[model samples]
Target: MRKVFLFIVLVAISMASYSQKRYENNYVSVVVPNGWVVQNKGDNGLGTELMSFYNDEYDANIYNFGMIIGFNQFQKPEFLLETQMNLKSSNPLFEKATFGKMYNSSFMGKSVKATDFKTQIFDETFKGTAYAFNEGGCTVLAVGSYKVGTKSDLPQIWRTVKWKNIRKDTHVYDSFREEIEAYCAATNKTLKQTPIVSNGERYVSVYLEPDANIITNTYKFVDMEKSSFDENKIEQIKQNLRPILLNILKATAKNAEIAAREMKEGYIFKYTYIDKNDEFLFSVKLTPDDYQ
Candidate 1:
């Protein structure tokens, strides 16, 4: 217990000093798992290694994901919480015994709150820790850990990491979002009002809400769906003035029949059926020339 507490305090106090990347001047800088993609970096120009981080196995059960001691192969890390706990329990030098825990929490000195997560895997268990320590300056360490089969895995894991220079984390570009936007633009889709999405909803979504003279390829994730539109109304609506939609369908669409439906409000064209296979929007097109 005392040794674990001492380690936590030591990490919290931070003997070594560092700052986040420049762009992260205000936002807290977080060290992410090595294989996770980092699209952008800080304010200063930094080497790709210093500027971004990514992980190969996003679903891999990674723990004790330490910067100063990260394993390269990622197949199996050397350090295991159980080994440390067992060591402390058996070692005569240590006075008290406690769970394998070394925790330090701070909010990049801004006084925000973020909790750590811990999970048990297979025969071994692990604890994930994330906290900012404001020692010389505020620094954040995000940890993920796993269990090792034997004591032999530890030394090699520690030695493989080039911990001599632990550089500040960075993100270089908005690759993911940028790609999404480009695809939507090419397809004439628009983004929804809010950037954040509901769980189970499209993590990233575009909309196809069309305007009077233009087809909106903007998308709304199904997670955000409400009772606004019914099958009756949907069946009644047709693909119209969004000029872009015509372009998109030009390649695959074999044929289309345009017609008009009389309503108390007004007359509208419906693209009723298309292609010999019955793949189309409405019964007619809303163009006046096609009404006759």
Candidate 2:
């Protein structure tokens, strides 16, 4: 019985909300609450707030927060409210904003926190549910959401918020983004949109345009020499070249058409673009180190 209780306790800690430890001088200061976590942010150590995270308990859903310090003043909790909306509709907040519930609320009732929301900035709508509280010359926030089983769980999950000492660490997304971006850069390609982390380390970039044909042939010409290409050497090279494009596209969709084929001089392996359509436009030809 004791072991069973101990195991459950460990699991609870492991699965509980995430936050860094904050301190003042030599004293122990409270970090962000345990029920809330940070996400999509660069490192700012544990003291300065700037981040976003997925709340496992938020009705088993996902959300993110971007904390901005000095944005709000004083010891009072001044919370900023915003949404990622295009403002296409006449009234976005009152009508279209589905990111959260009710009027934009604040942590401190008195102070005002400036807000900036960008909807479809990258040609895709990112539903970011975020909240920020500025206090003690510092800022803490929670934003974003994740896939959940049912919407009913939201209230119960949110109830877990400790709202005590919020701890957050910020690390620039540049390092990691640059790492993945390097893969795309090497292949002379740019992601259709900035990636939304589908889950840790992995990013999801979806391109949605009215014209389906535009996506179909985008990658056809780039990879057209598959048939004649040496299976091992050529394919291996192609994988090395455009790993990002391949990973994101493959994860989102299926069905690719081979636009071209060649093998004599060099191995050519062209396939349907990520959004494979009849207008195949990508191709890549690789040759063994020795000769074509």
Task: State the displacement of the C-alpha of residue 273, model 1, in Å, after optimal TM-score superposition.
Answer: 24
What C-alpha lDDT does candidate 1 achieve relative to the native structure?
0.28
Error of 2 at 282 (Å): 36
C-alpha lDDT score of every prediction, in listed order: 0.28, 0.31
Highest TM-score scorer: 2
Model 2 lDDT vs. the true structure?
Answer: 0.31
Q: Report the poorest 10 consecutive residues by lDDT, candidate 2.
A: 254-263
Candidate 2 regions exceeding 4 Å error are 1-46, 49-104, 107-128, 144-149, 165-292
Query: What is candidate 2's CA lDDT for residue 98?
Result: 51
RMSD of 1: 20.2
lDDT (tens digit, per residue) of candidate 2 on 1-292: 3312321221122233454333222111224455553222222122222222224434232333222222221222221233123221312211233543434365333233334333331122434344555444444444333232223223433433334443222233364333223333422221321221221221122121232212212333232333444557555745665655444333222211111111222322223332122342234422223122
